[model samples]
Target: MTVRLRPTLAALPAYVPGKSVPGSIKLASNENSYGPLPHVLERIAAAAENVNRYPDTNSSELMDALAAKFGIGSDRLVVGCGSVSLCQQLVFATADEGDEVVFGWRSFEAYPIISAIAGATAVKVPLDGQTHDLRAMAAAVTDRTRLVFVCNPNNPTGTAVSGAALLRFLDEVPSDVLVVLDEAYHEFVTDPSVVDGTTLLERYPNVIVLRTFSKAYGLAGLRIGYGIAADPAITMAVRQTQVPFAVTQIAQVAALASLEPAAERQLAERVAEVTAERGRVTAELRNAGYQVPDSEANFVWLTNGPAEAGGIDATAFAAGCAERGLIVRAFADSGVRVTISNPAENDKFVSAAHELRA
Candidate 1:
């Protein structure tokens, strides 16, 4: 007889990351094309020289920097290799067999994957139009639901929830249920109505706010991110679940140095530049007859629902872009998510879109 196994573990679908091609403009992962400041490079180099020593298991210094930056107490801060890892830790800490994890469909592709890995049932609520339907999401709650993920601006679509709407949603949901406010792209948003997630951590004990250094900070390769919350219990659970010395010594040094004054100014400037570029790209797409919601993130999502543009299917569109030395992320059959990496790549992508027409 064949040996029995944990069916969920054996049968779970694998996570597929965006492709990387040599010498191609890769706008696939929503990473910052603007590299980090010069001082951060020096810090990374210095940390590299100390590779023999293990990283601090608690990552105390980086945690102190993060706490000071966000004004959150150090006790409530949980550092991880990436916010993605924290996402997994959060699920493991709270979810048990038969418990349910909820998230909007087409938000972060990782939500369901993490839920499944944790042995929890993944409940995906469909998007209303192109946005996350908070009312529908709030209504989908059941007694077994222990966690809900809210990614804004929602991944692949780039639509963010309003401050007022989220406040109401929080009030409506059960206070005991943990809500993860994944704001990986929070720095890119220019909308006036969006809530400052860091501030919300002070007001909402149930909310765990996640942020990364990969986007505006241009540290995707470094793999440093953090989770902020008011609840010591949740933060402590995540800290306990994290592997010892999970974050590299280089990552810790680079992240701390990135929080310095000049580095932050550089990030602020880059944020303004990228948001403007995102606006420009969104308008260009809309002018070409594609419907788009206001993108509050660095990437733009193109829909191909019941339609095709000049014989260009969504997959074909992405493939065509790849052929032209551009690597835009394609969400097969759903749409294409194009990252605004830099001016040169953005121009190449725009050229590819226009060229595909002929």
Candidate 2:
């Protein structure tokens, strides 16, 4: 007989990552196409020499570097396999069976999956104008609500909430509820009004800010990310739920190298390039008659136009791009998300957008 699995497993939606075709220009996953700097590569190679040995379970050196970089106490920070792992750990930290975890729909795709795995109910509030509707989300929170995720510069949509709106939402949430600001794309944000989640820590003790080395730092393959909790207790809970030695030595050292002054400056330049390209891409798509959002992250979101107006929905548009040797993420019946890359790759995406425009 087959072993019985949790009944909730049946209804859970599998996470579909961006497609990667060998010969195609990939703008599917919101990944930085620019590779690591030479110095960081050197560090990764050096770290590889000691793979036979176990990684430090605590990732002490890396943790120290991040703590110092952010001017926070070491006790307030915790590292994980990626910010995604921290996302799961946060669910484990505050959520229990039947408790509700509220977040905006069309935000990070992982929120619902993780909440379900933890036996917590996922409460998805629909976005207003392709952006987080903070008022609606805050209103959805109840006493049973244990955790809330605000993916600022949201994934797949590339839209972020203003600081003022976020503040209003925060004021509405109960002080006992945990608010997680997943800023995996923190490095790519160009908007001045998007609240830096870190700055909210002092006033909101329940707040936790997550960041990653995978984006602009070009460390996606290595898998390392971290979170800073406003309260040491929350940090402690996240740490307690972490898988042992999940952060590898190579990832740890690579992240440390990426934080070096020279590396930081170089990475900042790369982010500037992506943001510049993002603006160009959005404008180009709009000019081509696509409904594109003002993106703050290293990607642009295009709403699927009305089918009655000879428009194509997300799936059909993605299929069209695939035929043209370009791969982009398509949220069925919703929109398409195209990652900003180097000039050549981005130009190919823009051309595809024009050809596919309704």
In the range 148-213, model 2's lDDT, one tens digit per residue, is 999998887889999999999999999999999999998888788998999999999999999998
Question: Number of clashing pairs, model 2?
Answer: 0
Clashing pairs in 1: none
Candidate 1 TM-score over all chains jointly: 0.96
User: Which stretches in model 2 have alpha-carbon errors above 4 Å?
Assistant: 307-311
Global lDDT of each candidate: 0.86, 0.90
Best lDDT among the predictions, by candidate number: 2
